[model samples]
Target chain A: MNKSYLYLFVRFVVLIALQVLIIDHINLGGYINPPLYILFILLLPFETPGWFLLLSAFALGFSIDIFSNSVGLHTASCVFMAYMRPTIIRAVGAPADYEAYLNPGIPDMGTQWFVFYTLFLTLLHQLAFGILESFYFAEAGIIFIRMIASSLFTLVLIVLIEYLFMSRKK
Target chain B: MRHILAFIWKHNFFFLFLVLEILSVVLLVNKSYYQRAVITNLTDRFTGSINSTYSSITGYFYLKQENDKLAAENAVLWQSLKHGLVTTDTLTTQLVDTLNRQTYRYTVAKVVSNSTGKRNNYIMLNKGKRHGIEHDMAVISPNGIVGTVVSVSDNFSWVMSVLNKHSKVSARIDRLGQMGTVLWQGQNPDKGSLTDIPVHVKVIKGDTIYTSGFSHIFPEGVMVGTVETIKVKEGDHFYDIGFKWSADLNGLSHVYIVKNLFREEQVELSKQVIDE
Candidate 1:
């Protein structure tokens, strides 16, 4: 198997395990539930096909929903993030041809671009997830608050994980 | 046909991802009803274990506080015991006897793991099905009511905390006897809202709120909270009353699960007339 594909598979397994076994039970605050599984989508190889990216995102979210017992909320949010990924990437002027299998890194793409990408994706994911989870229009304000709080938490974790672990890799 | 086949082969990974995503969405949207039961059960077990681990770690720090609270509660129980005889000696024994009958029973349990910050906060208690904790049992802290039992296992149970948006408890004013539904607004863990309170009824910010005992889940007079604020819209028939929850759900350590002995029979009988 290709080294990159092997790395992706191992990371995917580890992420899923950590999410279900550890993060799901770690309730930092009433409003903040960090969704680290989203890193699976964020870390995908740049050359991964559009259809594959969208599908992987959905699968990742659906697995979490299944475990958490929330219906369809995660799936919807994951798909929304997947759909928006390309637009954000293009607007930020990252490499167009993604055939080189370049990993998304701050050092490679510059800190500003990386921050914008993470913030946009994290916010989009949280907003879609929170609204769908509430499923009630009357609770829009409460859901928005929850989304913002969770997004902030998730962004911090994402950056920290990337900085500490992925950044050290060759 | 050969060109099409080549194209498909070239994008197999893309197609595979799409298929997986669609499959996930379908599973999420069409989650089997039975799956909910299984997931809830699994969650309860996992939460229970986590809570126990946390409790064990934190138990050392709380021993002094727990001992003091227990001593205080014991004193109250002793005083009540002493008063029971004196009251019976003076009043109409029959009326007082009937009034004194235990309408509710409680199962004491240690909080293994408890949380108040999540949108759907749940507490894990050390005692469970074997200890007489069943679904819908009211879980209370020393201060006041916390939540209702949602799932139970052999050795542990999960209480959906009052902070949860899905929690709804029937409550009434302590002084005026006016009734309303208490619901968590999800804005603050320590506060909730009392809806359907008639505007005409006299209500004040400091008035006490207690469970109405209309719901089989909780007995009458279980302290829920005190009215924090009352907003009566002009021309509206009801007031939006805010409640400051008495139970400090965030710092839960010990809890009592209230079991309604007649709940099963009552539910079965009521089910014959009303679809519950």
Candidate 2:
């Protein structure tokens, strides 16, 4: 198998396992169910093409939806994050001119840039997921509360995982 | 049109995201009919397994609390049993006089999983289809009514917790006997509202509320809550009644599943009336 395909497959399996086995059980009070599986989207190769990102994000979220029974909430949120990833990367400036094969790593992108990148992506993903999950104008306040709680939790997990695992890989 | 298509081709990701978001919104809005039932069942099973694992892990920490609760409950049960036996002779005469009155039976089960913060929260019980737990059975904690069963598997069932936005129970005031519909406001799990009680009915704060038994799901006199506030809406004839739920749902570990023996017959009879 191609190295990229092999890498992507491993990443998919690891993320799904982590989400279902570990993160799903960490309720942490206040209805904060973090979707750490979005790390798969975050770690996609920088040059993986926009359509592929959109499709993969959709598939990742749809699979989670199938597992969590939340219908299309996760799928919608993941696609939104994938769509905004490029813009967010550009806004944060190219991570050293965006090398095609460069995986998103703290060492490659610097701690500060990676933090901002993960924060924005995690926030976007949580906001979309929370809003879609609530799906009621009357629930705007509760949705906001859930969004903030879930985003904060997801951000902490993303940063810890990046620092511990991806930082070591580099 | 060609230029638009070209622009769309250039911004395919953005278009795809928009389409997916729209599709999701449509699905959410049409939850009544287009809900993915199969997916829900699969997720329920997956969650059930995951929760069981976590329950085993956390069950260790909760052993002391569970033991204490059980001990306290056992004391109460013993006292009640003794009192009932002592009053048996007198109660026999009263029971014969009220032979036509309704009676309720309670079956106990532990709450395997519970959630309070979600817009549509649910609780899972250790008992299910094999345990005579059918759809629409009312679940009550030691404090008050929790919710009704929404789905059931062979060994487990999910209850739509009273904290959910969709929860509605028929309730009546204990003192005044004024009736209203109790609904979750989705703001606080400890509090809910009783709407449609006529303003003319005399009601006071702290009035006890119980199930009206109008619904096939719950039996009469199951504790619901107490009136915390009775605000007469300006220019409206109905009072906006606030209630403090009698059941401490967040702290609930064990609950009773109430099965109405006459539910099937009552439902069939009602359906016949509607058909006629």
Candidate 3:
């Protein structure tokens, strides 16, 4: 448990830093702006306490918000995605009795479940973030386009990261 | 109480979800730019549209007052334009001063009531004897002649609209200089006929027709209408002319009633000549 906590803490700092310093500045022609810090929530162990999950999600979102100069948008979307994680896991019929030390990742969950989990959470996060950022019905079309493009971009990056770095379960 | 506590404990995650959602909302609303944009978008979609629709409805109610102010301003412009040049140049001072008489005065009046569907269509104006509007004064809109005042009360006057069967005005072809009388045929509000234009004159389909100033009611060169068609039957000495109406009489809201300053003097002189 202690080792996993430490791992989560380290992952949090690395992802937040990467998101703020590099990804935030990248402009793919002002479209497909990937937000990868959401991987932090997706990687959290299924056994995490609900309140702790919510708090950590808020903290991660707030940190990204501070860096991006978008005050509450990232924080709100992150917390919302975190709140929705269990429902998504249940809907996807993940094993009810998850290992205490195990996390939702490419190595443990296989390629299909991991992709589905990551893409679902990323889509939800991007939706909340985009809708909050552009608060107008007239902008719904452009917002939908941005959300889809950014979600796909973020999903690809997260799957690539997990495949390249995570140890395969034997 | 224990059941309630158990229920609360059982649904603790949902409560946490609700609480966290509330907190995020508060942050979103209280934060700068992004949150404001969200709130603005939500309210703009819902309340903003309602407010705009409401204002648009109320805006229609204000059009009458706005039109009244516009008509009054137009009256001043028309008065100055018809009164001739008030010269300040030293060389033309003596010559221009003699010419600059206030031969015409104008009063802005709202069309309180109007009709085009009626054969003897009459327009009721908001101004009457109290506002210096008298019977026989000519009425015109910004576009063209509307009618002549036929009767007046203390605060209201009735006008003979150009669509009325009794209405007649001396008009001429602007390019041809051929004088004709414009009279309504008691049908077709959009059209009128120019009578007494002889067949020998070259009347084209698009020639402009204007007031001939012979009636002493309307000013010279005021737009009447454009000649729409010209027909000359065999053995007929006069051309049958149909002209399209220049002013939208059915939708008239603002009009100027012309008060000719020299009208009474002209009438008296003409009457004396008739009596002799």
Model 2 chain A: worst 10 consecutive residues (lDDT sum): A21-30
Better of 2 and 3 by TM-score: 2
Which 10 residues in a row give candidate 1 chain A its minimum summed lDDT?
Answer: A63-72
TM-score of each: 0.80, 0.80, 0.45
lDDT of 2 by residue, B20-121 (tens): 777766655565522444444556666677667666776787789778877987888888764655654877867767786445557798776776655566
For model 3, the docking class works out as: incorrect
Question: Candidate 1: which docking quality band?
Answer: acceptable
lDDT of 3 at B46: 36
Which residue runs of candidate 2 sit more than 4 Å off their true CA positions? A1-36, A49-52, A62-69, A145-153, B1-37, B40-44, B87-107, B201-205, B229-233, B272-276
Q: State the lDDT of candidate 2 residue by residue for A1-170, as single tens digits.
A: 39878888888878987785566545455457788898899888788888788888877877665444456777778888899999988888776665665767687878888788888889988887777666579878878887788788888888888888777675
Q: What shift in Å separates residue A101 of candidate 3 from its native position after superposition?
A: 3.6
B122-186 in candidate 1: lDDT tens per residue?
Answer: 67778877887777899887778998987777887767888876789999999999889999877
Q: Mark the regions of model 1 whose C-alpha exceeds 4 Å error after superposition.
A: A1-30, A48-72, A79-87, A96-101, B1-33, B41-51, B58-65, B82-102, B269-276
TM-score of candidate 3 versus the correct structure, residues matched by position: 0.45
Q: Candidate 3 chain B: minimum summed lDDT over ten consecutive residues — where?
A: B43-52
Misplaced by over 4 Å in model 3 are A168-170, B31-276
- The residue pairs found clashing in candidate 1 are A30-B117, A30-B118, B51-B112, B51-B113
lDDT of 1 at A154: 85
Q: List the residue pairs that clash in candidate 3.
A: A135-B41
